[model samples]
Target chain A: MRIEHELHARRRSRNVGLGLVLLAFVALIFALTVVKVRQGDLMEAYDHQPRVSLTPLDTPAGAPAEETPAGVPAEEAP
Target chain B: MTDINAYDASPEGEFRDYVALLKPRVMSLVVFTAFVGLWVAPGQVHPFIGFCAVLFIALGGGASGALNMWYDRDIDAVMNRTRSRPIPSGRVQESEALGLGIVLGTISVMMLGLVANWFAAGFLAFTIFFYAVVYTVWLKRSTPQNIVIGGAAGAFPPMIGWACATGGIGIESILMFMLIFVWTPPHFWALALFMKEDYHRAGVPMLTVTHGRRSTRRHILAYAVALAPFAIGLGLTSIGGPLYMAVSVVLNVAFLRGCWQIFRRSEDQAIADDYAVEKRVFRLSLYYLFLHFLALLVQSWLGGW
Candidate 1:
């Protein structure tokens, strides 16, 4: 009876350890999925090229925009 | 003192015991400093990524705590403060804690890499290894200088936070790291001074046990002297402002005075008062770290405004 009880205790402890391991593994997979979904197209593009340029911003009229030579709006003239 | 009852007969270790194994108090400090790091950095990260970074950092810290508890189970069983810990109390088996620690540690690092930047993930991995392998398994049993060198492990969260935001390390990150590193010795040794008997019983070789209390006191004073300059020096960096400088000055002055008082007292007085001075110093040390990081957060907010 003593030996049988000891074996059962050992088995129970092993199962508990296994459960904790499984929980941690599940959490890791969930985290990885979240990162993947969030990255979207950015990950794909970054993999292909190392550098990307930013698109220029459009300035509204009479909004203290960057001054062109002759004090004329470059976008307006051309 | 020798026969004090530290562990009580609780129910067989359950999920809660496992959570307790992670040392949540320590994890909180890790989270706060890492947040400060993320907040003060000079760029913006998506809110989601920032949150993920902090989460993974906290997990990594917890993982380290779990591993420490696992490895130190033998000594922990003997120490009064640690006797009630999961492993010592037979609530959770040692191997279970070890496995939990390893799995969580790996997951946290990998998630940090995928969610934030590789730099942050790599730093987290190194911090875990440093604490688990270098400190827990090696330095802890070997020398009294364990906490001094091991302090690096706790100091990495802020740098990890900085990396999450900037995707690289900078002077500001190093300063944050140095602040914690310098603060650790004095903070921990204060507790060690009070808990010398516990450490002696456990054969842990703390500074007070290996060297005399007088030496430990002197060491605390020395570290406090060094810490003040580093604390105040943060004010001159890009992250610093008048508010942080003022707070740092006052805290450092108060801390230095405390250390001086600790140094002036003899072992007899410490024993007579049940090491009240040492205990007060330990509590103050906790407040010191929180206030320092809080001051940094305030400075960052004020700077933005």
Candidate 2:
């Protein structure tokens, strides 16, 4: 029968704590990457192609409204 | 074959010892002020990014704290207040503390740059260097004005948080920075007045030890008076509102009154009263800062409504 020494218990706890910290770090980095990628998509999507869903059908000029789903406001008529 | 048990024979620092090296109490204050600064800034930050920014800032603060513990271990060993610290108590090695500080500091700075702006990253790097090299290694032992100058290290977090949101500095952030910077001297001097013996024993040239308690009291009152304009000035900034103004007025009046009382009391009276007033002022200083920041946060929330 093997008896676990008190020192071993302390060491185990230390190892577990360090492991948890590292795991958390990895999770945070992954989450950050996803959020950054999603934001990039939002920024580039509007410029790449016309999004018909974003256009306001009620407007006669076939233009997006002053405050449309795309978040771009209509410019004042010159 | 090598003995696996050999490593266990020698003493090892527990996980909590490593955590203790980070100075969690100071980190909490850093986190709070940085959060408040980020909240009150003009632009909106993504929730995740804001969370990461504050975390990185806290890590930077913690890293500086570790470096401070490593450098000041000698003085810490001698001071009764610090005798039980991780390094002084033999729970953590000096080299380990230094290594942790450098690694954490680097990671925090880099991550902040990637998630926020380079300006905030640079500010965090400067804050770490200022605290670790300028304050801990240089000014702390060399001059009685150590706390006065070193206070800048603690005052930068709110500005950094503001930068994280706006990607640039602003007058509002400057005002917040000044409020903390001016308030630091009196806050620390009050503690120094009551804990003079600790500094005396540790050989640290605190204002109380080098300038005498009388001079230190005078300095506290002087700084307290100087602190009023900055504290009140923050209320007029873009972030301030009626709530903030009222809170600042009351807190400043109470703070000035406390300082005046400390300034008037003789050493004999302080001793007879067991430094009751000095201790009370020190506690009040904590509330004074917390409430000021809290009022700003509430005003920001109210503005949102």
Candidate 3:
């Protein structure tokens, strides 16, 4: 019986390595997913919130800065 | 006088069998790429919404796996590498895999649309169909170019991720798609080189099985050389930075060299070394994509984005 079970386990998990890979990934996703929308807040969020900002990332190497969201309006640009 | 779950004659399998049908390893890759897609996109996703989006994408990937396993069971039973898979082993039934595939695939698409955007959900739906039907049913048995074209299915995750964030596509997302699409051929061909026997026995017309090893080797080299520009171009995109460029340069050089070694090897030399060089290249291919994406993620974490 034990022999049969071992053979079954061997064939079953074929690449236990892959299973490990999956578990590690799930754990990582779980860790990263800090907030959960209980009542399906998807539409409201997608309708209102833009997950990534649309602002341009760069202004040619020597361009002057404007609308510094990262800094106080009165303070000097870092 | 029969039980339904006993669709296969074996010990009725276990809880793990259901998970096995999902091909968790492939799901991991999809989850990683999709999360990176959402993370690196120009805007910010609410934490909860982002979670739901990635979850649905992951489930969708799993559903594709179940379907693949269900359909491929016949050939899978013939291939040593896949014979032990649940459906083929009869530990879990084909009917069970099909059911799981439909249920999970539907739920995932609907939820992704609800949580992300319709465009992203639609993209996810297309990806599932492309993988389950177009690639598996239509492509796998029919041609040597199966992976070359079918690679599109694997390449869509990051694009879907990008859509989840911005609700549309851009050159950066397209380039991301191109990087994976181009990367798939060389990656799988190298594995096929080593495992051609399994493909031959299974009657799957993998490039290595249909084309001789020498030809497959040349193709690997061609793709490795071709993959360079897209990978580097991606590094120059909004998502790229000095760090990405450095990593890309180093990795690309090593990648080209690996392919060169494989290309130059005679069958005699390969057999002598037990295809050691081919095996090494195959393993490196896994790291190649991961580091590229990881560098992008790290760059973003460091505010390069």
Candidate 4:
């Protein structure tokens, strides 16, 4: 027969609480990541690649765009 | 047979004891104000992200509370009010509290930065530093104006919340911050008025201890006067609507009257009544802040829905 001590019970509760907190932390991080990724296109970040969609209608081809080399292909714009 | 009760002499700390170290009552106020700030801000946060932001902010607040308890454990043991706290009551060790505080503080700040804007995360970090290092370590034991300055720490959560939604600060957030900043002194002084003996016994230099109750009463009145403009002025800002304005006006009137009554009472009268009026005013003061924030939330709901 097992004799369960009060100290052991208290220790078990403490461990359970800590485990729950760690589990919640993992779930929250997962949710945050999913929300951020699902919100927009993966390639939306500026990466020094020129796209015609970002260019002003008035700007001539081969215009010096910030973060983009002059005269990048319009085909790459999405 | 071995004595099963042998371990009872050195009681193992329970999970609740760690929660007690976090000061959940104070955390509730932090959570509410931060929520109102996030909701009233001009931009929208995705619901899930917003939830995470508030959770992290509350964790930050709790971390500061643990650090405060760990630092003030000495005085906490001496004071009637805090003598039963986890550290003081021997349920938790001071070192464990300190470690928990550091770990939680770090996690909350980092997760907030990742889930929200870096600016909001930075604001949370500054608030934790202000409350734990600036208020608890520096201002609390040194001067009569401890709470006056420490009030700024409590005042930062809403700004952090606003930043979470807007990614920046604005006049509306500043006003929300000011509302709590101005309210704290009078609120705490009323507490100090009644808890005077505890402060005296603890040797912490609360205004009531350093300046006497009459002076404390006068300070309360002064802060109430100072508080009205911020409270009323917030109602005039972008977040304020008719409901908020109406509630603010009524609460301010009631608060000013309470302060005036406390201000006018003679020491003899206060003692004769056993500080009943003072206690009543303190109770009113709690409702005063809660309803003000609740009104802000209602105003936002009305405007949105």
Taking all chains together, the TM-score of candidate 3 against the true structure is 0.79
Sorted by DockQ (best first), the order is: 4, 2, 3, 1
Between prediction 1 and prediction 2, which has the larger DockQ?
Answer: 2
Q: After superposition, how far is residue A71 of candidate 2 from its true place, in Å?
A: 38
Clash pairs (backbone) in predicted model 2: none
Native contacts present in each candidate (fraction): 0.00, 0.62, 0.08, 0.83
Q: Which candidate is the best by lDDT?
A: 2
Off by over 4 Å in 4: A41-78, B1-6
- Tell how far residue B171 is off in model 2, in angstroms: 1.1
Model 3 chain A poorest 10 in a row by lDDT: A43-52
Which lDDT tens digits does candidate 4 get at residues B19-99? 988889989999999988998998778999889999999999999999999999999999877888999888898899999
Local distance difference test scores for all models:
0.85, 0.90, 0.84, 0.89
The digit string of per-residue lDDT tens for model 2 on B60-148 reads 99999999999999999998889999998887878999999999999999999988999999999999999999999999888999999
**Chain A of candidate 3 compared with the true chain A, TM-score:** 0.30
Model 1 over residues B179-273: C-alpha lDDT tens digits? 99999999999987876557777777788878888999999999999998888888889899999988888888888889999999999998999
lDDT of 2 at B230: 88
- What are the runs in model 3 whose C-alpha is more than 4 Å off? A1-78, B1-11
Model 4 residue B42 CA deviation (Å) reads 0.6
Clashes of each: 1, 0, 8, 0
